[model samples]
Every structure is written in C-alpha cells, then in structure tokens.
Target: MALLEVKNLGISFGGLRAVNNFNIQIQEGELYGLIGPNGAGKTTLFNLLTGVYKPGEGSIFLDGKNITSYKTIDVNKAGIARTFQNIRLFKQLSVLDNVKVGLHNQYHYSTLEGIFRLPRYFQIEKQMNEKAMELLKVFNLDGYSHYKASNLPYGQQRKLEIARALATNPKLLLLDEPAAGMNPNETAELMETIQFVQKEFHMTILLIEHDMKLVAGICEKLTVLNFGEVLISGKTSDVLNDPKVITAYLGE
Candidate 1:
C-alpha cells in the first residue's frame, strides 16, 4: 500500500482556486519531487496535506486510512511531518532543545510528572536527549548541538529543521524548498543529506524544489505543476524535457 495518497485534492481561497485536482501517491521510502512556478499552488498543497488548510475537495489517506480533515497534531501523530519554505527554528533555543521540543508529542510523561521531576520523567528526558543527539550525529550537527539555532550558518539551520522533523518519527516527510538559499556546494551536500536521511530513517520524502538540477539529481519521480494544476508526472528525465514544462518555465 502507498504510504501517502492524495486523490483529486483541491483547495481554494474565495473564488481563486489555489490547488486544483492535485493527486499523488507515494510509496514507502520513495523520494519524489513537486516542482512548479511561483503561485502554482505547491505550498498550498503542502498546507492541505499538513492540515494547515482544509481541502476544498477530495481526500487524503495515510497507510490506507482516511485522514483528509484531521487536525495538525493528529496528522503528525499519524506519521506525517514537514519543514517549511521559511526556516521555523526557535532562534533563542539551543539546537538540541529545539529538536527536543519536537519530541514533545511522542513523550509520554504527564505534565505533573514533568513538574515534579518524577523518575519516569527523568527517564523519558534521558531517552529524548539521546535520540536528539543521535539525530544530530546523523546530520553531522553533533558538534553544534549546544549552539543557538539562530547562530548557526544558514545551511546548518536547514539541517536542524530536518532533524527536528525526524524527531516526530514520521513515515512521510514533506520538505518545502529545502535548498532555497545556498551555494552550489551547500546544495550538493543537502542533496546527499536528504538521501541519507530517507535511507537511514526509512522514511518517504516528498520535496518541493525549484532547482531543476537538484530535483533531477535526487528525485526518482517528478511532478510539474503550473497555474494550480499538474502539467506532467513521470520520470525526472521525461518530465524535465516535456514541452509543456519548458514552456511553463520559459514562455513563448
């Protein structure tokens, strides 16, 4: 069964349909790309999947279970996590703390236990810290665990966001324009890091990226959107070479 399935999904703001009849099916451990021009509704679709906005039409299924209108926290609990186009780290918090906060949903200790510092609370805290550190190590950010999130270079901050999302133990990870600001070297490293995280965590990834080279390099399948609808969906080489995709990128 597919890990995630979006069937004829759509959403609109007033009379303006931002996403129209969008659909995708992602199997476990698959790495896929969603590409589109600005205002093509890529982020709006992400919002629908992540529960930031309710879909005006269609349904979403995860692990064969319907989750079309679930709450945001409910969606997270159902094994979906995402990073935004804009970095959303807690700037003042230590990198480790920022990741630890992501574990809050998974942590089982009660509020009373936390306030009282019960033995179970301490035990859970220890486990969370260890897991957070392990994630940092995987992303090669262990040395910066104690650093303030805002103080890290822009690239490291992006890595931290991925690490934090991993803390949710998701089955599917949605990365929105993870390479927005970086030199070629940094973007190259991020490509490898993304692949590594998918393999190491055994997670499916659906990424939205503008960099054709980056998308073509990493994504096994590509979906192109324009003006809120799919232009093409196929192998990276095929979709990238499509006349419609070319026209969308470079108008006549």
Candidate 2:
C-alpha cells in the first residue's frame, strides 16, 4: 500500500481553482518531486497535504487513514511535517532551541511540570535536547548550535529549517523549494543532504522545486502542474521531454 494517497484532491478560492483533481500515490521510502512554473499550485497543494488549507473536494489518506480535514496539529501528530518555500525559524532563538521547539510534540511532560522542575519534565527535556543535537549533527550544523537562527548564512538557515522539521519525526516530509536560495555548490551539497536524510530517517519525501536540473537529478518520479492542474507525471526524463511541459514552461 502507498504511504500517502491523494485522490481527486482540489482546492479553490471563490471561483479560482488553485488546485484541481490532483492525485498521487507515494510508496514508503520513495523520493518524489512536484514541479511547475510560477502559480502552478505546487505550494497550494503542499498546504493542502499539510493541513494548512482544507481541500474543497476529495480525500487524503496517510497510512490508510483518511485525513482530508485533519487539523494542522493533528497532521503533525500523525507523522507529517514540512518546510516552507521561505525559511521559517525563530530568529532570536539559538539553533538548538529552534529544533527543540519542533520536538515539543514528542515531549509528554506538562507545562506546569516544567515550571516546577519536576523529574519527568527534566528527563524529557534532556532527551529532547539530545535528540535535537543529534539531528543538527546529521546536518553538520552541530558546530553552530549555539548561534541564533538569524545569524546563520542563507544556506545554513535553510538547513536549520530542515533540521527543525526533521525533529518532528515525520514519516512523510513535504519540502517546498528547499534549494530556492542556494548557489550551485550549495544546491549540490543540499541534494546529497536530502538523500542522506531520507535514507537515515527511512521516510518518504515529496518536494516542490523549480530547478529542473536538481529535480531531474535526485527525484525518481516527477509530477508537473500548470495553472493548478496536473500536466503530466512519470519518470523524470519522460515528463521533462513532454510537449505539454515544454509549452507550460515556455508559455510562462
């Protein structure tokens, strides 16, 4: 069975359909790509899957359970997590603290217990810190764990956002334009990092990226969208060479 399934999914604002009749099935450990020109509804689709927006039609199933209307927090608890097109981090917080915030859901102690310095709270906090550090190490950001998130360079900030997302222990990770601001060298390194994270975490990834070379290089499957509808989907080579995809990119 697929790890995640989107069946005839769609969303709209008043009369404008932002996404239409979208369907995709991602098996466990698969690395998939979602691509399109600007305004192709890729981000909109990400929002729908992550529960940032509710679908107007169709259903979403994760691990065989319908979650078409699950709340955002519930979705995170269900093992789905994501990073935004623009980096989102707590600027003033240390990188370590930013990651720990994502670990909140995994920590079971109550706020009162933390305030009172209860034994259970202390234990959970220690565990959370250890886990956060481990993730930073995996991304090679352990050396900067004490730096504020806003102090990191653009690429490092992006990595930190990803590290923070991984802290949620998601089974399916939705990455929106992870390499958006990266230079060629940084993008190259990020590609490897993404693959490493997927293998290390044993998770499925669905990424929305505009860089065709990067998408073609790493993603095993590709889905192309245009004006909020799927133009084509298949092996990367086939989809990129398709006439419709060419037209979509050129016409824009």
Candidate 3:
C-alpha cells in the first residue's frame, strides 16, 4: 500500500478553485517532488495535507487510513509531519528545546509530573534529550544545542527545522522549499543532508521546491503544478522533459 495517497482532492477559496482534482500516490521510502512557479498552490497543497485546510472534495489517506479533514494536530499525530516554506522555529527557545517540542509528540509525562519534576518526567526528559541531540548531531547543530534557535545561521536554521520535523518520528516527512534562500554551496549541502536523512531514517519525503537542481538531485518522481492544477506527474526525467512542462512551467 502507498504511504500517502490523495484522490480527487480539491479546495476552493470563495469562487476560485485553489487546488482542483488533485491525486497522488506515494510509496514508502520514495523521495518525491512537487514543483511549480509561484502561486501554483504547492504550499496550499501542503497545508491541505497537514490539515491546515480541509479539502472540498475527495479523500486523503496515509497508509490506507482516511485522514481527510482531520484537525491539524490530529493529522500530525497520525504520522505526518512537515516543515514550512518560511522557517517557523520557536525563536525564544534554545535549539535543544525547539527539537524537544517535536519529541513531545512521542514522549510525555503528566502535567503534574512536569510541574513537580517527578522521576517519570526526568526519565522521559532524558530519553528525549538523547534523541534530540542525536538528531541535531546529524544536522551538525549539536554544538549549538544551548544557543537560541533564532541565533543560528540561515542554513543551520533550515537544517534545524528539518531535524525538529524528523523528531516527530513521522511516517512521511514533507519539506516545503527546503533550499529556499540558500547559496549554491548551501544548496549542495542541503541535497546531501536530505539524502542522508532519507537513508539514515529510512524516510519517505514529499517536498515542494523551486530549485530544479535540488529537486533533480533528490526526487525520483516529480509532480508539476500549474495554476492550481497538476501539469504532469511521472518519472523525474520524463516530467522534466515533457513538452507541457517545458511550455507551462520552465517556459520555452
């Protein structure tokens, strides 16, 4: 069964259709790309998948379970986690604390235990600390664990966002423009990081990226969106070479 599936899904904003008749199926461990020009509704699609927006028609399934229109938090708990196109870190929190927030989904103690610093709280806290640090180390952010999340360089901050999302232990990870604002060298590093994350975590990823180079390097399959509709979906090379994509997306 596919890890993620959407069938005939669509949403309209007032009289305008923002996403119309979208359908996609992604297998476990696949790295897929959603690419388009600005306003192609790529992020809107992410919002829908993450439950920020409910679809007006059709169904969404994760691992064969219908999750259409589930509340945002509930959708998150159901094995889907995503990073935003705009970085959304807890700026006031320490880098470690930011990651721990994601870990909260998996490890928890009662509120009383937290308030009183009970033994169970400490136990869970220790486990989360170890795990969060392990994730930070993967992103090479371990040495800055105590620093404020807002203080990291832009590239490291982007990495931290991904690490935190992974801390949710999600079955599917969605990255929205992971290479946005990156330099050529930073984009190169990001490609390696994404590849490493997929292999190390055995993760399934679906990302919305404008950087064709980054998309080409990592995504095996590609979906092109144009003006809120799918232009094409197929093997990366084939989709990139499609005449429709050349005319509508890349421009002849």
Candidate 4:
C-alpha cells in the first residue's frame, strides 16, 4: 500500500475553491515534489496534510489508516511532520531547546513526575537532549547548539528548523520551500542534506519548492498544480518537460 494516499481532496474559502479534486499516492521512501507557480495552493495542501487545516472533502490515509481529521499535534504523533516556508524556529530559545520542543510529545513521564522533577523526567530529558544534539550534528549545527536560534545565519536557521522537525521522528516529512532564501552555496548544501535525510532516515518526503534546480536535482517524481488543481504528475523529466507545465509557469 502507498505510504500516503489522498483522494478527492478539496478545500475552499468563502466561495473561492482554493484546492479541488486533488489526488496523489506516495510510496514509502519516495522523494516526491509538489511544484507550481505561486498561489497554486501548494502550502494549502501541506496544511491539510499536516492538519493545520482540515479538508472540506476527501480522505487522507497514512500507512493505510485514515487520518483525515486528526489535529496537528495528533498528526505529528501519527508520524507526519513538516517545516514551513517561513522559518518557524523559536527565535529566542537555544538551538538545542528548539529541537527539544519537538521531542516533548515522546516523553512518557506523568505530568506529576515532570512537575516534581522526578527520576523519569531527568532520564527522559537527558535522552532527548542527546537525540537533539545528534540531529543538530546531522545538519552541521552542533556547534551552534547553545546559540539562540535567531543568532544563526539564515541558511543555518533553515537547517535548524528541519532538525527540529526531524526530532519528532516522523515517517513522512513535508517541506515547504526549504530553499526559499539561500544563496547558491547554501542551496547546494541543502540538496546534500536532503539526500542525507532520505538515505539515513529512510523516510518519505514531499517537498514544495519553486527552485527548479533543487527539485530537478533530487525529486524522482513530481506533481504540478495550477489554480489549485492538478495539472499533471509523472516522472520528474516528463513532468518538467510538459508543455502545460511550461505554459503555466511562463504564460501562454
């Protein structure tokens, strides 16, 4: 079965059908791309998938179990995590603390145990910190672990956000424009990091990227959206070369 399947997905706001009749199926460990011109509802689709916004119609299944109406936190616990187009790190917190926030849900200690600073709390906190540090190392941010998140360079800030999301231990990762504001060097490093994540974590990834170079470099397959509807989906080479996709981006 597909790792993620969405059928007849749709949503709207006040008579504007922002997204309609969307459908896709992603296999486990697939690196899939969601691409379209601005305002194509790519982020809206991510929100629906992550439960930031519930779909008005259609069903979402992860590993063959329905998760259509699960709330955001529940969705994360159910194994979906995402990074935003805008960096969403806790700016004032230490980089390590930012990652630890994602690990909070995994703490099994009772509320009283946490409040009283019991042994379980200390044990779990230590484990979480070690795990968070490992994730920072993967993104090459270990050296900045003690710095405030806002103190990192813009590119490092982006990596920290992804590290925080990974700390949730998700099976499916949705990245929204992860390369939005990077220089060429930073973008290159991001491609390598993404490759490392796919190989090391063995996770399914759905990426929304406007940078064709990044998408072309990594995505095995792609789906194109136009006016909130699917224009086409196929192998990366075929989808990018489609005349409809070209026209959608460059105008007829």
What TM-score fits each model? 0.97, 0.97, 0.98, 0.97
Q: Residue 2, candidate 2: how far off, in angstroms? A: 0.7
How accurate locally is residue 83 in candidate 4, as Cα lDDT from 0 to 100?
96
Model 2 agreement with the true structure over 1-252: per-residue lDDT tens digits? 999999999999999999999999999999999999999899999999989999999999999999899999999989899999988899999999999999988788888998999999889989988999999999999999999999999999999989998999899999999999889999999999999988988879999998887999999999999889989989989999998899899973
Q: Rate the local accuracy (lDDT) of all candidates.
A: 0.93, 0.93, 0.94, 0.94
Candidate topping lDDT: 4
- What TM-score would you give candidate 1 relative to the actual structure? 0.97
Ranking by TM-score: 3, 1, 4, 2
Local accuracy of candidate 1 as per-residue lDDT tens digits, 130-200:
98999899989999999999999999999999999999889899999999998899999999999998888
What would the per-residue lDDT of candidate 4 be over residues 1-252, giving only the tens digit for each residue?
Answer: 999999999999989999999999999999999999999999999999999998999999999989999999999999999999988889999999999998888767888999999999899989988989999999999999999999999999999988988989999999999999999899999999998999999979999999999999999999999999999999999999999999999999
Angstrom error of the Cα, residue 174, model 4: value is: 0.3
Q: Residue 118: error of model 4 in Å?
A: 2.6
**TM-score, cand. 2:** 0.97
The runs of at least 3 residues in candidate 1 whose Cα sits more than 4 Å from the true structure, single-residue gaps closed, are none
**Number of clashes recorded per candidate:** 0, 0, 0, 0
Which 10-residue span in candidate 3 carries the lowest summed lDDT?
Answer: 243-252
lDDT of candidate model 2 versus the reference = 0.93
* Cα lDDT over the full model 4: 0.94
Q: Residues 48-123, candidate 3: write the lDDT tens digits.
A: 9999998999899999999997999999899999999899999999999999999987897999999999999889
By lDDT, the better pick of 2 and 3 is 3
Task: Choose 1 or 4, whichever is better by lDDT.
Answer: 4
